[model samples]
Target: MKSTLAILAMAISVPSMAIAQTPPPYQPGMGDLMVTIVQPRHLKLGLAGQARNWDYADYAQHELEESLEAVEKHIPKWRNLDIAALMAATVKQPLEAIEKAVKAKNAAAFDASFKQLTDACNACHQSSNLPAIVIKVPDASAFPNQEFRVTRP
Candidate 1:
């Protein structure tokens, strides 16, 4: 009888212990996503363009664009600011211009468009009361593990 009671108590407590041990799902903030995904891709794209690695630049540009889209989708409204509208007004044209420059493989055009994109990013930050978050062209490669130079087949 005592063994039966012990078994019942253990079975009842097991589920509670499991529940207590389980962690909550991770929820990343807007800044977290930007720093982790968008910023790195933007830097890499700039590096690829500066290196005249058109193929890699094309891939990196698309990745950056997709990251922006994901950010807008995930956080349509942040702190009462409409992220989608802000992105459309500020970044859409610059991103399109960058895409055109990438497709044409025009380094000068890419540089101009990239500057526009960076300016738009800063503008958005300023408008959002985050003037301290200023983005610029990377002077050096942050990723030493990956090569920005194009490899000929």
Candidate 2:
């Protein structure tokens, strides 16, 4: 009877022990999400457009949009400013233009739209009082292992 009680107590305590050992969920800061998620997608989009890789450009653009959406959802406000509103005011239109350009596979349009997007990013930074965070057209590929230029089939 004592052994049965001891076994029952151990079973009940096992779950509590596991719960205590588990770490808290990781909640990344806004800057961390931007650096880890948004920046790479933006770079890839620029590189794809520059290389005239429309398919990759489209994919990159979509990824960027999703990253931005995720950021807005995760951190709706930063420094007391509404991030969603800021994004809508700044990057939203440019992203739409970029999507249209990508769909059309127009290199010229893509270039112009990409410039607009880059400028919008800079503008957002400035408005957010992050004047030092200047974004521009990517002149060099950040991913050395990945080829930006599409090989002709």
Candidate 3:
């Protein structure tokens, strides 16, 4: 009878120990999410456009747009400013223009739209009092592990 009680206590305590060992859910800050998701996608999109890799450009552009949307969704307000409204006012048209360029597979238009998009991002930063956070055309791929070139059949 004592052995049965000991075994039951052990079983209950084991579950409690396991639960205590589990880590808490990860909740990334706005800056963390932006750096991890949006910034890389933006750079890749520019590189893909520069390479004239239209297929990859289209995919990268979509990923960038999605990242921005996710950012706004997760952080609707940052430092008491309305992020969603800011994004809509500054980025919506430029993103649409970029999407148009991507669909048409026009590298020149993509370049122009991408410039507008970059400017919009900077404009948002400025409005948010983060003038030092400037975004620009990527001169080089920060990602050396991934290929941005078009794969010709």
Q: Report the C-alpha lDDT of model 2 over 1-153, residue by residue, as the tens digit.
A: 999999999999999999999999999998999899999999999999998998888899999999999999999989989999999999999999999999998989999999999999999999999999998899898899998899865
In candidate 1, residue 153 scores what lDDT? 56
CA lDDT, every model vs. true structure = 0.93, 0.94, 0.92
> Which residues of candidate 2, in runs, are more than 4 Å off?
1-14
Instruction: Evaluate residue 16 in candidate 2 and report its C-alpha lDDT on the 0 to 100 scale.
Output: 99
Ranking by lDDT: 2, 1, 3
Per-residue error at 72 for model 2, in Å?
A: 0.8
Report per-prediction Cα RMSD to one decimal: 1.8, 2.0, 2.4
Which residue runs does candidate 3 get wrong by more than 4 Å? 1-23
Candidate 3: pairs in clash: none
Worst 10 residues of 1 by lDDT: 144-153
Give the best candidate by TM-score.
1
TM-score of each: 0.90, 0.87, 0.85
